[model samples]
Target: MKGTETKAPGVPQALVDLVGDHFLEAARYLREIQDAYPKEFVSVAKKLKVGRRKAYELVRIDRRFHDLGIAPERLRQIGWTKLAHLASHVDADNVEKWLALAETVTAHELKMLLRGTVIDPETRAVVLYLDKVQYGIFETALLTAGAIKDSGCLLNREAALTRLLDGVVVE
Candidate 1:
């Protein structure tokens, strides 16, 4: 379960610059996790001592190696109640939100939401401003948005969102 290289050709220099060193580090971490766990999120979660909900949060926050475990078939097989059970281990409110969001979105839509704009302009601008003080903030926002879009569940979404800055390039 190696990480598939996501080489978006002609990606803007600004975006590439934004990605910088940390992106590589995060990517490496994801790859390591994939190699070790290989599509066994539940088992990995147990080994990490992360509750099911926390594991879902981690998966949602990062999709680079999400395919390692939690296949689409397995996800489809999990009923709402069971999904809720897993989510409840982290945050019950997030579980409901994630489930609801999942109902309205396709995987493509989730991907788009992660890399594209889903927030209003003013908010985006504010986030961009804040990100200048801390570059890592923007990356977290991007990841959190991806998590929310992908898992359809997120706790501290507002906090996660606060990390983004409007008009800022985050690779």
Candidate 2:
């Protein structure tokens, strides 16, 4: 996957710059708050207006990755969700391999892999975040194209997208 790109198409470059690796910064700030107010950390997190669960998750990832000396660049590259799955298993010795694996697989598949489940090496995953209207359009398009099934399983959706793309001609 060396030549493969991780793209956020339709997202503004300025927005991307402004939001660069924000989760890493959030983790750092949350850790400082935790250190200053050990007992009231959860309350502090709540007061910050972020969900308590998300705050805890950020803290956990921060502590684990910080203690392991994982670089911010690498963490940003792997993204938070996949890093959560890799956190327990990653160390100085195996960090590179785990990072590469995380880059190649989706978070769900990475979770399954960590749990000793076998997955197809050739399988790839794409994650999308769409607004309500965008999601409606996308769902309709895929459903109309017969890409999505009644059950709407992820694998089926993936296959549908692949099949649709296979017919496309790119210049």
Candidate 3:
């Protein structure tokens, strides 16, 4: 993960230089706390001033990076969010490829790529915070439109939503 001279495409050298080593230091410290104080680990999020999820993420990043022997500077350049997304997928052999990909894409896009989703830069996401009743209605519509499965997984939500919208007859 370090000392490899191959530069990631679309990531400027200046941008990489702008990223500091603070995240790597934080990840290392968090990991130390996790290993030394396993019992008191639950309070780590409060201590770090981050949500529980983010605290755990840092620990995971540190552990994975350490185990994989990834360079701290390389991880710093990639940043925590992307590294966290990559932690589970990267191995010694593939770390550089994944890090390069992370550098070229947004974290959300990287997650999608890891999930086997094709990256379409033009495609966008829309989020809605629906109440229980509204969620039920929306779920039903998606189900009927074949966007979701009986197992409650999304199949092709964008296509389904497009079909649903296209069905509306204008006055």
Tens-place lDDT digits, model 1, residues 72-154: 34444433233333432324335445445555654434433444547443443133345454755644565656535345545
RMSD of 2: 13.4
**What is candidate 2's lDDT per residue for 34-102, written digit by digit as tens?**
776566667655555557767777787888788676678878988878877776887779978888889
- Rank order by TM-score, top first? 3, 2, 1
TM-score of the candidate numbered 1?
0.20
The 10-residue segment with the lowest total lDDT in model 3 = 7-16
**Every candidate's lDDT:** 0.43, 0.70, 0.73
Minimal lDDT window, size 10, model 1: 18-27
Q: Candidate 3 clashing pairs? A: none
Q: What is the TM-score of each candidate against the true structure?
A: 0.20, 0.54, 0.65
Best by the lDDT measure: 3
- Comparing 2 with 3 on lDDT, the higher-scoring candidate is 3
Candidate 3 similarity to native, TM-score? 0.65
Model 2 vs. true fold: TM: 0.54
Candidate 1 achieves a global lDDT of 0.43
List candidate 3 segments past 4 Å from native. 1-21, 67-69, 127-171
Question: Judged by lDDT against the true structure, how good is candidate 3?
Answer: 0.73
User: Clashing pairs in model 1?
Assistant: 39-68, 39-69, 60-147, 98-152, 98-153, 124-166, 127-164, 127-165, 128-165, 128-166
